[model samples]
Target: MTFSIPNLLSLFRLATAPLLALVFLVPENQNIANIAATALFLLAASTDFWDGFIARRINQSTSLGALLDLLADKLLIVTALLLLLDAERAPVGACIFIVGRELLMSALREWVAQNGKSSTVRVIAVGKWKTGLQMTAVPFLFYAGDLWALNTLAVGVWLLWAAAALSVWSMLSYCLALWRNE
Candidate 1:
């Protein structure tokens, strides 16, 4: 509950989720909206890296800060996925796998924590890869256009698909670890 700097960064990311959706609501300025949303998404995603780094560096890590950081990441990514889906930049099936995996993983984490086996479901390498790919994809998806010489939307969709696959892979990895722990 302490208003630590890391927690504040997490809160900023959480708040930016809704604003990203709102950015797309600007009916007349779709180009401007896309640019703004992409910028905001990148900014928020960068905070995901910084919050954890700063927490560890400054010895400000707490259970609350950890929870806030996790929640903020989930919120931001889910909101962006929904936005991409609504705009037709993301495939429906990939979105389903990504979102469904997230829900299942979140529930599994809670169940593990309640059973006093939280470490069994702690973030794995695959999970980190999934998150990194997801964060990278979303901004490109949000832009949905060329960036210099690259067709961002195509790159984004490809990355999103990879992320989705990793989502399933990470979920399976976590479940296996949990089973082994028990």
Candidate 2:
């Protein structure tokens, strides 16, 4: 349970999750809140990459750190998605699929861990792609505005659907791999 730098970064991301919702509390300053939430989400998402990279690079990858990192990623992502859903920036169908897949995967991982088969359900390429797409889409959704000639909300919705598709693919892939290993 040593507090490594990477673990601290994860904690920072976890702490930032609730802050995103707080920004939306000020409906009078919608534009400013949107910008602030987007910035916070981007910063938190960047830490997800950095924490893992630093952990591996520095040879400080501990079980606790891994747990912290996973928790942080889930919390931040779910919070952002929920916020986007509430703001009507993300589609209901996409949110349901994404969040449902996440919960299912989390439970499956726990079952595998309890059975001492955790290696059977390791994170796969599709899962990484899903995370990447989600991370990219979330900030856009949070901003929910136009950037010069680009409509970010449209792009975000497209990317969110893609991420949701990837989530289902990744979940099925993991399940198949686990079943085969079992």
Query: What are the runs in model 1 whose C-alpha is more than 4 Å off?
Result: none
> Model 1: per-residue lDDT, tens digit, 51-139?
99999999999999989999999999999988888888998888899899989988998898898999898888898999999999998
TM-score per prediction, in order, is 0.97, 0.97
Q: For model 1, what is the C-alpha lDDT against the true structure?
A: 0.92
Where's the lowest-lDDT run of ten residues in candidate 2?
19-28
The Cα error of candidate 1 at residue 120, in Å, is 0.3
Residue-level lDDT tens digits of model 2 in 32-119: 9989898888998999999999999999999899889889989998999888888889999998999999899999989999999989
